[model samples]
Every structure is written in structure tokens, then in C-alpha cells.
Target chain A: MKFSRKTLGIPYGVFLTLFVVAPMIVLFYYAFTNGQGVFTLRNLTDFFTDPNTLGTLFYSLAIALTTTVVCLLIAYPVAYILATSKLKAKSVIIMIFVTPMWINFSLRITALKEILTLIEGNLAYYPFLNSVLGMTYDFLPFMILPIYNTIVKLDHSLTEAARDLGANERGAFLKVTVPLSLPGVVSGISMVFLPAMTNYVVLDMLYNSTYIMGSLIGSYFAAYNWHGGSMIALVLLGIICVFTLLTDSGEDDARTGGALL
Target chain B: MKKFRRILVPVLVLLFLYVPILMLALYSFTDSTQIGAIRSFTFKNYETLFTTDELRSMIVGTLLLALGSAVLATLLGTLGAVGAFYSKKRTSSIMSTVNQIPVINADVVTGFSLCILLVVVFGIPKDTYIPLVIGHVTLCAPFVYLSVIPKLKQMDPALYEAALDLGAKPRTALMKVVIPQILSGMVTGFMLAITLSLDDYFIATYTKPATFDTISTYVVNATKGSQTDIKTALWALSTLIFVLVIVLVLVMNLNSKKREQKEAKA
Candidate 1:
């Protein structure tokens, strides 16, 4: 629909301005300014001094990494299965994986904690494994979808060509399918990796924050430490921006490039 | 022989992927009744969920969160899609990419940042619905934008041109002509957003007011409480939701088949 420039520009301008752009500027500004409204580096310095806050950055990353590796290991086979098999009801399998994902994420995590508690006393019964499993269950979809998409797109002829050569079954898969599905691997792992590293909610829900980064921020907020919270977010945002820049995951292009469509 | 291996590998993978969810649903039924000797049969757990006031309220709250976020997300997403459509600059590409990040970003990180957005920067009181909605919408709107923008891009300029030529107002053209063509895409985005909003947890924990709760939270709380009735209800409820989702998906698939048949006939 054609319209006056104002009609077209004004509405979205307000939205982006108010919601996206404005808050971002305010957050960065809030990070620098103190309670008296003068500029200071205290918040940034304080972020570094607190072991709990600073330590969470790594804790968060470790969680994401652990989840990514596990998810990739599990998802790759499933992706390959979906890509290779002519099984009836492929959509059914897909639906089952996605169904829980559609239910309340918080609820699933909540349920997970319940299940863990029943399985053992509390996750304290098996702290490390519990956290990993918690992450694995929740973020499995992120790892699966992109890899599945990638596996589906892999050139099947390559596997055939590899077989025609002297390569054994394992070699053919390793040399052909794995390499060919690199984009999906790249995309899927990238999807899994970044979020896994940043995620602390699963850790919070399943474990008692015995060792987690996200929980620190949660507690800080709970304690009414706005200045410290903004500083933490600003730091995380900077790290994310850099990571996005380096990987150039092209996720934006893929989604809008008619991947899901 | 190679083909057989291919078939075997995929079947195993399918089993692996689909097993945990099925198991979770199964265990939910048995959690309470099968007390000793591996008691695997009973609906007592499900009974507790339905009977408990807290569980009932949580279910309602989760449904409300999903519904509210999905509606707001779909509306904002449509606007973002429209904005993306009109965007001739490289900025749309960047925005779309940035928009896509939250969908894949660690929920914990987004929840953390959103906490900052609401409780810290805006001085929004902690443990309120506003933060909950904002957290959900931030995550959900991008999916809607991703879903709707492509359809909007594919619209025929001629249809719009004709409407304008016939003296239809800009708003009318968008409402009557543009929306019809893009309705399916919009619907897809809305469904996605609904699911996403429903799926949220990380944000709920952070932003949810101290006393506030949801289906997910209740399950977690109950597990921590006694590992009994409330937990089973959550399982039944999650199963119910899954069943409903499966049915809805089947219906949509059938509807799409019918549409394709009609199109082919036409």
C-alpha cells in the first residue's frame, strides 16, 4: 500500500526508537553514569572486581559449550536420519521434538528440575551432569533444526561418489556427508554455541546456582542492584556483538533468504 | 548393504530423538502411584494437577503469558515485516539479522539483558507482568518478522497499484489486498510466536514477580516440594499440550493439502 512518507516512517520509527534503539542507548548510558548522574568508570571496574559476576561469563560459556558439543553429537545423527531415511511419518518425529519446545520453556525447565529431583534427591545428587542434561534437553531443538536443514540440503551424490571410490562406509560418511553438511553444522553449532554459552536459566532452574554466572545477575537484580546489572548486560552485549561480527553466521540472511520459507 | 546401513542409522536416530519426550510423559504418570517395586501404572499424579489450586492457577498464568505475548508479538512482528518491506537500505538486512539473534541467542543472556532493560534501566519494578511480556515479545517478534516478511516481499505490485488506482486508500490496500496475500505467512509467524511465548522459562524466572508463577514454575516448585501430585499434573498438562499441538499440525497439513488440490484444480 502506497502512503504518505510520514505514515510509512513514523510508526516504525517510533517503535524502533522507543523499544530497540532508545533502550540500548539508555543502557549503555546507564552503565557509565552513577547515582549522582555524573560519568564514572566505577560500575565497569566493579564488574571486574566481583568474582561471582566476572566468573559467570566463563561459567555461562562453559555451559553453552558443553550443551553445544552434546547437542551436536545427538543432533547430527538425527539430522542425518531425517536427511537420509525415507521413513513414513518423518514429520511425526519432527513434531515430537518440537512439541515440548512449543510448550512453556520455563515449564519444561521446571518439569526438568522436578524430574531430576525425583530421579535423584536434588540435582545436588549429580550436580555437573544434571546441569549438562538440563541444557541438553532444552536447547536440543536449536542444535537439531539447523543441522537438519543442513543435512537435508547436502548433495546426496557425493556420498554415492565416495562409495564409488575406495572409501569404506565410515570413510564415505566422514569424507562426504560430514564435510558436505558443513553449512548446517556451521549454522547449527553456531546457533547452539552462542546461546549455550550465554544461557544461565537452565543452570538456575535445575541446579541451585552452586556454580553459575547467570544466577549472579539474577541475584544482583533481586538485590536491587540496577547499576551493577546494567554494567553486566553492557559487557555481555559487547561480547555478543563481537562474536556475531566474527562468525558472520549469516543467520539473518539464511532466515530471510527463504531458508525456513 | 550400504542402503540398509543408511536406513538403520536413520531409524536409530529417530528413536533417540523421540525417546526422551515419550519417556518424560510416561514417567509423569508413574511418579506418584508406583511408589515402590517400580510402580509404573496410575493416574494419581494427573489427578493432583487438576485438583490443586496452585497448579490450576499456574496453567492459567502460562496460557495467559503465551497468549498475550503471541498477540503482541504478531502485531509488532507484522509492523517490523512491513517496515522491512519498505526498507530499501542495507539496514533492513542488519535489523533482520539482529532480530534473528534473540531466537537463537542463549535465553539466559537475553533474559539477563531484558532484566537490565526493565528492572535496571527503566526502573521497572521487579516481578511484574510487564517485564514478562517484554521478555517474551523480544524473543517472539523476530520469528514473526522472519515468517511474515518473505510473504510481504512476494506480493504483486500490480495488485497494490490497481487498488490505489481505483481510489482505495493506502490503509485499505494494505488491509484488503496485501494482508490477504500474506495471511498464511502471518499465520505461520503467529503460530511460531505463540509456541515461542509458551516455551519461555529463562525470562519468566528472572522477570516474574516474587509471588507470580506459571505451569512450568509450579512443576519445578512441586518437584522441589514433594515430587508428587503437582509434578504429575504438569506432565499430563505438557502431554495434553503436545497432543493438541500434534493435532493442530495435522489439521494444518490437511488444510494445506486441500488448498493445493483446489489450486491445482483451478
Candidate 2:
């Protein structure tokens, strides 16, 4: 008996339907309905109107934006150095930066919390700083890996050609290398930005704070307020969708280079 | 000065990355109740880590789940990639986009929504491992798909056709020819899935059985409570995990490097 190639996808299709598609539908349903299960736009209106929710949303955005910028600033130069260097063991160095990810993140954060306590008397005082530091520490490798992969695969001759045309090293890098590596930079931004927005773990472990979107949804669910949690999740999903669309373009090449494990 | 700056910048960044892990490693050896203050040096933490039933069970459970879900995720992910690679353009595109939803979505949202769908709506009990395993597979399968798709794209399309033309059944061709070409990808995907499952906190928090705790969930709860022995023991656990990871990554890198050299020679 012949099995069509398309039929091989049947299990995955069913899995996606049951898990991915159904959960989303359920989220939308819960977001739109109240405890009585009657459909209402109150959740939406409440999200926009409630100052607490709105504050948390804006605060989470600010944190995510700050974390993304810091990660990029720190990661770009490191990625650039590692990728462009003639050192034979650069792969080992890159592994050093990335292997930290393998240690359980909670443990890493706990370790960070300890170091911070040593540096500063109480962590509660420097919540924002610690949060940013924790995030930058955790997500920097992600930013580094993509940018390194992209820069490593970059056309070296383009920069050399720019140099041949009388462009200085800085000019050549700015014009050739920078432009070509934008896909990596953009992907790194998306990778860091989206997760930073929702990774309340960093905040929670570092400072016991719960003002972010992730903890907000978690709190709602913990309190049995699925409606509010779903609403926040829907809003977060919308933000991620828009961010992804804006950043979407030729990521296949950048992604194909890195092993990511 | 310029060369020195490049070296210095990377060195400092690497230092920043390693400081926390180094601190954990250092503390694991000391008989300190907290991270900062160090007293006498001892191996009590390691002893506690190995001996405690709670810690042992949690560690074992987490590893078992990671391996189990990774196997399931690899299967689904490989099938999806293979199927999509061979299917019509529209079908493949749809499959890719659907797969991306879970990948791009936040974990908190995925966990909450899955909890609602399976536990609340579908009437699956929270205590059962069904929700937890399904949640992990859902979390991981998309990544597997991503990793495997590249291998499918890299494989020569003619090879599968050639096998079929040689009178091999489609199943046999896929199993014998196509599968071998993509096995490396499947292995990478499996490893990735395991790490992701091990690292996950939010999804497990929502979908896991009431009594069960993965390392992430356990650490979070344990740190909140005042069990100094368990808390200090976790530092030892962290050191052990860090060492294990270093060894695994070094071995994998060396193996890959060897493979590349062999390919070059060939």
C-alpha cells in the first residue's frame, strides 16, 4: 500500500489543531466572555481603561525595550569580535557565552540574586537595575549567536570592495557590514524583545516584583480570574504579532547558520 | 590600543556572563546558608542534593519528562518537516505559519491557554500528567520542525525520487533514504527539545500535576520557602548542572569539528 507524502503530516496537523488552534480559540472565548459565559467586550475595555493593567503594559514595554537595547549594545561588539577574529578557538569562546544557557535559568538567576545582594545590601531597592541585568545576562547569548552567525557568513569581499573604492575601515563597516547584518540585528531584537516583555521570572526571582505582563497573567490565573488573564494574554499576543511582522524578512538565512543548541 | 580594546571588551563581557555561575560554584563548596557569607568549607550541600528524596525525585522527574517529551516532539516535528517539504506550496506555507504560532507566542500565554483548553474546557484533570506532556510536546515540536526543515531543504530532492523510482516503497524510501539524510537534524532537534523542557517554568507551572515539580518550578517554590538545606543544596545542584553542560557542549563541539574535518578530507 502506498502512503502519500502529505499523509505523513496528518499527525502533526491533528496535534496543531488540538493544541495550538484550539487553545487560541479557547483564549479568545475566555477573553470575550465573563464568569457567566456571556459574551461581552468588558475585558477589552477594562484592559484599556484600568490604570493598573495599562501601567503594567506600558511598564513591561519599557522594560523589554530597555533590555533589548542593552543586550544589542553589549552583544553586537562581542559577536563582531568573535565572528571577525582570526582566532582558531573563537568557536570555543562563543560556546563559553552560550553554555551558561544550559545551566538552569532559575539557578543562574538565583546566583545573580546572591551576587547582587553582596554588591548591594537589599535587592528590593534596585529592582529595575537588577531586572535589566538579569535579562541582559540571560538573553545576551541569544543576541550574540544570531548576530555572530550572520556576520560570519557575511560576504567579506563587499567590505573589501568598499575599501578598494577608497572607503575607510569605519565607512566600509558602516556601509557594507552593518547593512548586510541588519537581518541578524532585527532577529536578535525580536528574540530578545518579545521574551523580555513576558519573562516575569527575572523580575520575580530578582526582586519579587509582579508588575510585568507575565506575572500579571500568572496572578490572574492564580486567582482564578481566567478572563482577565486571557485578556492580557490576547493583548500580549497582539503585540508579539505586530513585532514579528515588522521584523519579518529574510530571516531564513540568518537562522540557517546557527546550531542554536 | 585598538586590538587591546577588542580583546578587553570581549573579555569583560565573558566575565560578566560567568560571574554568577562562578559565584554559584564557589558557594556550593562553602557551608554558607546564603550566597554572600561563607563559613567553613564543606560538601554537605552535595550530600543533601543526592540524599534528599524531594530533590532526587524532582531531578529524576524533570529528566524523564525532558527525554519523553523530546522523543514525542522529535517524531511530530520530523513528520511535519518531511511532510511539508514534500507537499504542495500552499500546504507547506500553511504548515510553516501554523508551526510558528507556538514558537513566537509567549510561554505564559501558551501555558495558560493550554490549561484552559485541556483542563478547563476538555475536562482533563490537572493532577494527570496528560496536560503536562501535551503542553511540553506542543512547546517543543515547533522547534523540532524549525531545526528539521533546514535539513530537508539541504537534502537532494532527487535522492528520494531515485529511491522510489528504484521500486522502493514510499515508506521504505522515507525510512531508508530520507530519514538517514535528516537524522542529524532530528538529533539536534531532540537535544533542543530536552533543554527547552528542562528550562521551562511557566508551562509546567500551569499544566503539571499538582504534586509534581520540575526543577524550575521546584526551585522557585523552594527558594520562596525557608528550607536552608534545600536552598543551599540547590547551589550544589546548579554547580553540577553547569559542569555537566560544559562537558556535553565540549564533547558535541569536538565531535562536530571532527565530522567537518572528515567531510573536508572526503
Fnat of candidates, each listed = 0.30, 0.79
**What does the lDDT read for residue A168 in candidate 1?**
90
Give the TM-scores of the predictions, in the order they appear: 0.84, 0.97
lDDT of 2 at B249: 92
Q: What digit string (tens of lDDT, one per residue) describes model 1 on residues A1-261?
A: 546422443454455455555556666777798877799899999879878666777777777778888888887877777767777766555555544555555556655665566668656767668778877877677667777766777777788888888889899999888887776676666666665554555666676456555565566666866666667767777776776666666565444322232
Q: Candidate 1: how close is chain B to the reference, as a TM-score?
A: 0.88
The whole-model C-alpha lDDT of candidate 2 against the native structure comes to 0.90
Clashing pairs in 2: none
**Local lDDT at B195 for model 1:** 68
Off by over 4 Å in 2: A208-210, A251-259
- Model 1: docking quality category: acceptable
